[model samples]
Target: MKFIAEIDVMPLKEILDPQGKAVKLGLGNLGIQSVEDVRVGRHIQLHLEAADEASAKSIVEEACKQLLVNRIVESYTYYLAEFVLSN
Candidate 1:
């Protein structure tokens, strides 16, 4: 079976997001005052083969913990689904 994982990685809430702040400041300079407290993060999509949903989920979770996210400074969340043929 094939599975798809949609993942989100983000800086920890306690960690300051300098990039987000810079973008927010830039937006303010552009007269976009409505936007504030902006935060930046990454999205990742993965397709892989697995025996079942449980196996797929375990693989994705391990990947996130071991490689995708920095446990100390960043966190990750993911959604997994079985791949289906539309045609």
Candidate 2:
């Protein structure tokens, strides 16, 4: 079976996001000041072949924990679903 894995990695809430802060400041300069608590993160898309949905999910989770994200200062979120093909 084939699966699509969508993952997001972000800095911990207690950590400062300089990129997000800079964007917020730029927005304020543009007269957009209502935004607060801005955050920046990475999005990853992967296609994997697995025996089943459960296996695919597990593989992706493990990959995220091991390589895709830094568990100390960052957190990761992922979703795995069977790939749908339309002909």
Candidate 3:
């Protein structure tokens, strides 16, 4: 079966996010004061083939733990779904 994984990687709340802070400052300069805070992160989409959802989930989790996520300063969340072919 084919699967798609939607992953999000973000800095831990205790970690300082300079990029997010910079963007927030920029927004304020642009008169967007309504923004209380900002947190910037990456979104990734992966298309994978596996025997089933359980297998696909295992692959994705391993990938995240081994490479995608930084355990010390970052955390990740993912959503998995079966892929459907369109006519």
Candidate 4:
């Protein structure tokens, strides 16, 4: 079976995000001050073969624990589902 994994990685709340702060500052300079705070993160999609939904979830979790996430200052969340082709 084929599965698609949608993953999100973000910096921990206690961590400082310079990029996000920069974006917020830029937004303010552009007269967009309504935004109070901003946090930048990464989104990743992976398609892979698996025997079942459980296996697919395990694979995605392993990938996140091993590489997709930085446990020190970042965390990750993922959603897995069967892949279907559209006509």
Candidate 5:
């Protein structure tokens, strides 16, 4: 079976996101004042072959823990779905 994983990784709330803050400041300078408290994060999409949905999820989780996310300062979330082929 084939599965698709959509993952999001973000800095911990306790961690300061300088890039996000800089972007917010830039936005304010550009007259986009309504957008505040901006946060920047990473989005990843993966397609893989797995035996089942459970297996796919486990793979994705392990990937996040081992490589995709920094446990000390970042957190991650992901969703896995079976891939369907269209004729």
Candidate 6:
């Protein structure tokens, strides 16, 4: 079976996001305002071949906890779905 995973990696709420701040500030310069506490994150799409959805979810979770996220400063969320043929 094949599965698809969508992962989001972002800094913890207590952490500051310089890039997001910069973008927010820049936006103000462009006449956009009323925005506060902006945050930036990464999105990852993965495809895997596994025996079942549970196995695929475990593998993806391990990958995120061990490599994709910095555990201490960042956090991650993921969703898994069975791959389906369009035809």
lDDT of each: 0.93, 0.90, 0.95, 0.95, 0.92, 0.90
lDDT over C-alpha atoms for residue 45 of model 5: 98
* Per-residue lDDT of candidate 3, residues 10-78 (tens digit): 999999999999999999999999999899988889999999999999999999999888889989999
Clash count for each candidate, listed in order shown: 0, 0, 0, 0, 0, 0
What is the per-residue lDDT of model 2 for residues 1-87, given as tens digits with 9 covering 90 to 100? Answer: 889999999999988899899999999999998998689999999999999988898899888988999988899888778898988
TM-score of each: 0.93, 0.91, 0.96, 0.94, 0.95, 0.92
Return the lDDT, model 3, position 49. 99
Reference-based TM-score, model 1: 0.93
CA error at residue 65 for candidate 4, angstroms:
0.9
Name every residue pair that clashes in candidate 6.
Answer: none
Question: Model 1: per-residue lDDT, tens digit, 1-87?
Answer: 999999999999999999899999999999999985998999999999999999999999989998899989998888999999786
TM-score-best of 1 and 3: 3
Clashing pairs for model 3 are none
Model 5: per-residue Cα lDDT over 1-87, one tens digit each: 999999999999999999899999999999999996988999999999999988888899989998999999999888889999987
Compute the lDDT for candidate 4.
0.95
Point out the worst 10-residue segment of candidate 3 by lDDT: 67-76
- Model 4, 4-83: lDDT tens per residue? 99999999999999999999999999999999999999999999999999999999999999989999999898888899
Residue-pair clash count for candidate 2:
0
Worst 10-residue lDDT window for candidate 6 reads 30-39
Candidate achieving higher lDDT, 2 or 3: 3
Q: List the residue pairs that clash in candidate 1.
A: none
Give the distance in Å from residue 80's predicted Cα in candidate 4 to where it truly belongs.
1.0
